[model samples]
Target: MKRAAMVVNPIKIKDMRLLHREVEQVMRRHGWAAPVWHETTIEDPGFGQTQQAISDQVDLVVALGGDGTVRNVSTTLLGSGIPLAILPAGTGNLLARNLGLPIRNRKVALRAALAGRDRAIDTLFVEIDTTGDGVADESAICTVMTGCGLDAEIMASTSERLKARAGWLAYPIAGLRHINARRTPMRIALDDNDFEDERPLTTVLVGNCGRLTGGVRLMPDAEPDDGVLDVLELSAERASWAPLITQVLSASTRTTSQVRHRTAESIRIECEEPTRVEIDGEVHEHALAVRISIKPKSLVVRVPRSSKPS
Candidate 1:
């Protein structure tokens, strides 16, 4: 029987024992051996466990957490030729939603993953500079969206307690509290200065795939394996997100002074003041600037063989 590594976040799961038994039943029915499970910890989320999976030479790795868990697992699995499967267990299962994978159903996701058909997707390599000195204080690989400004603030301000109780609704609650926050003055350069702009922006989102938690298509044209990133720069001067959200929801490409969308292979963002940045759903150390580059076809992800990916 083939082996699999299950990297799970216990906090995201409701009942560990029952979940284990359920997973075992699926493995047995599918002719896969009982999986070697590795639980994610507060100190070490999914990196160490995913690395272990690679060392163990498992047939595939299943990530059973939220976007953060999937991001961490995929970062380590990138370029390893190991296929990754995600079971939506977080507040924003953006990747699974974007890929049309089974959402919030671990059994179905695991079974589909085990069945076959994996796709190669792109990943972002980000270097964040905290000191404004132009040196990267931290670097990591991320799949899905990463950005600064309002999005990061909302992610940071959201209470885990409320998130546990309300799920995606918690983000809207946090957003309402932060709706009046000030925008940051920044300069954005795309493709090594192929195009550049300066403005006070509320949020700058770069997505490998476009689709946020609330069914808002932040970047309507983003494709994970398209070998580029979609950039959305939003600005609102009057402490109002109404106009900005309206523009996004309507899918208008008529760039207003407040909303701009572009496609790039690499991007550099420098802000006048320190800013919080969110990669996937977790907020990272405040950064003065960030540099992001796309790695084409870097990660292989499990998907339904016959289903058309979103």
Candidate 2:
């Protein structure tokens, strides 16, 4: 019998009771035999709870929330070699989509969690290097993408109330509000190459996986276990409403030729002024510089066996 635990965010979606029932039914079907459950509190994220579950020797840990919740679990189980399963209760189920997991029905997600195939996926470690002590201040493991600049600002400015009502579409409204803001120049160094850009950037994203919610393909070539990170620099010059509209049109066809893409083992970003950073859609305070690296095959996640592309 495989012992499993769930770290769920109770406030994610409107149908909490139904979600719980589905999860319980799936566990019974798989003969999990009374699995443990932990609810994530505002004070302590799912990561801390997941750590406790691992310490309790659970064979599998499931994250029952959105992208932020999944990221927290990923950080906790980075090197513990524990496999993670997702119950996509969040607005933007980016990581779940990347894994080719079903998200339309809670029962399907739960069944996949209970009896799905496992695949090794790469995770990104993002660290902020402070100026005063030259020491890193904060760091986290992200399964999807990390970004700074305008996109981060949009994430920061988006109100929880709006998110509760509008879900993932709330981002676009916030993005439009900040579209005309002046761009800040930044210095970018990827692997061994260095470049400077003067245009105000809307967002600079680094992705480990290609699929994003809403069918947006920010990094179409990104592969989760490829041992490399895909970097995308979106400047206001290129990311304006017109270009963005064009990209959205192209993304409908699964084409990313309108967007910029680069792949590297690591990346360094610096700006003349402080910039906000968002990892997996959760915003962080201003930072002068951030270093990101790929932890190849650091996580094992459940995916559909028939979902793998040939």
Candidate 3:
């Protein structure tokens, strides 16, 4: 019999026991042994626990949490050939949204996760170099997307308390505060191209998938299995944000002069000054430079066979 492990974020679900029972029932019905459950702690957000599951040689690993927990567990399981299933439980379940997983209903979501086919997805290998003295380099496997600039600022400004109370609405509330910040300068290089000279940058995002929160399609051409990253850079004055926001909210990908996009296998970016950086909606303090590359078919994810990515 194949064994499974569930890395759950207890804080996100109301009844932990009930959640386990449902997943357990599905596993048993599908010829899987009772799942070994691991709850994420405040300090360790499922990374180490996922590593443990990998070490145990489980046939499948189910992640039940927000994007952060899913990203952490995916990071640990990268290149292991074990399929990771996502059960959306938090505000921004970006991966689940893009994969067309059943996000609203827990029982259905769990069922889809367990019965899904193994889908190989490209993972973003990101390295961020911070500016401060003695600050260590940070790296992770970004599942959906990562960005630097205004998007990172919006995430940084969103308060945890407000996020816990207001959910996704908290992001817009915090974003209103930084809407007028001036664009920062950046030098960027795509693949083998030479560094593009400094330009005022509003935001630069590298995406493994196209969809954002609220069904927004930021990268029209992004695909998880495409073996390349979709790069988008926004350079706009404060006044330009209005139409851009409208285009995004409406899920329109029509090209605008203010936005430049490219599809590349690798990208390197350097900022004129320290700037906030974010991956999979988790914001970091600041970064001076970042190098991003894609590992094609590096992560095995479970997704419904009938679901086609847009």
- TM-score to native of every candidate shown: 0.96, 0.91, 0.94
Better of 2 and 3 by lDDT: 3
- Residue by residue across 1-310, what tens digits does model 2's lDDT show? 7788889998875776766677777788888866688989999878689989999999889898889999998889888888999888887888888878888787787787777788899999999865634567988888998988887898899998988899889988888788677777777888777755544555778889877657777676788999999888765553556965667446432324335567899998886688889999998886788889999999999877666421
Best by lDDT: 1
lDDT (C-alpha, whole model) for all candidates: 0.88, 0.80, 0.87
Lowest summed lDDT across 10 adjacent residues in model 2 is found at 249-258
Give per-residue CA lDDT, model 3, range 1-310, as digits (tens).
9898999998888987788788888888888899888999989999889999999999989999999999999999988889999888888788998888888888787777777899999999888889644344998789999999998999888876898998888888888898788999999999989999899999999999988766678887788999999988887777898877776666555668777778899998888899988999889867988889999999999898778542
Instruction: Name the regions of candidate 3 deviating beyond 4 angstroms.
Output: 132-136, 249-255
lDDT of candidate model 2 versus the reference: 0.80
TM-score of 1: 0.96
Off by over 4 Å in 2: 13-20, 130-133, 193-200, 237-240, 248-259, 308-310
Could you give me the TM-score of model 3 versus the true structure? 0.94
lDDT, residue 43, candidate 3: 91
Superposed by TM-score, candidate 2 places the C-alpha of residue 236 at a distance from the truth, in angstroms, of: 2.1
Superposition error at 274 for model 1 (Å): 0.5
Q: What tens-digit string does per-residue lDDT give for candidate 1 at 134-250?
A: 999998887999988888999998988999999889998998887678889988999967435568899899889888777777788888899999999888866466787788888
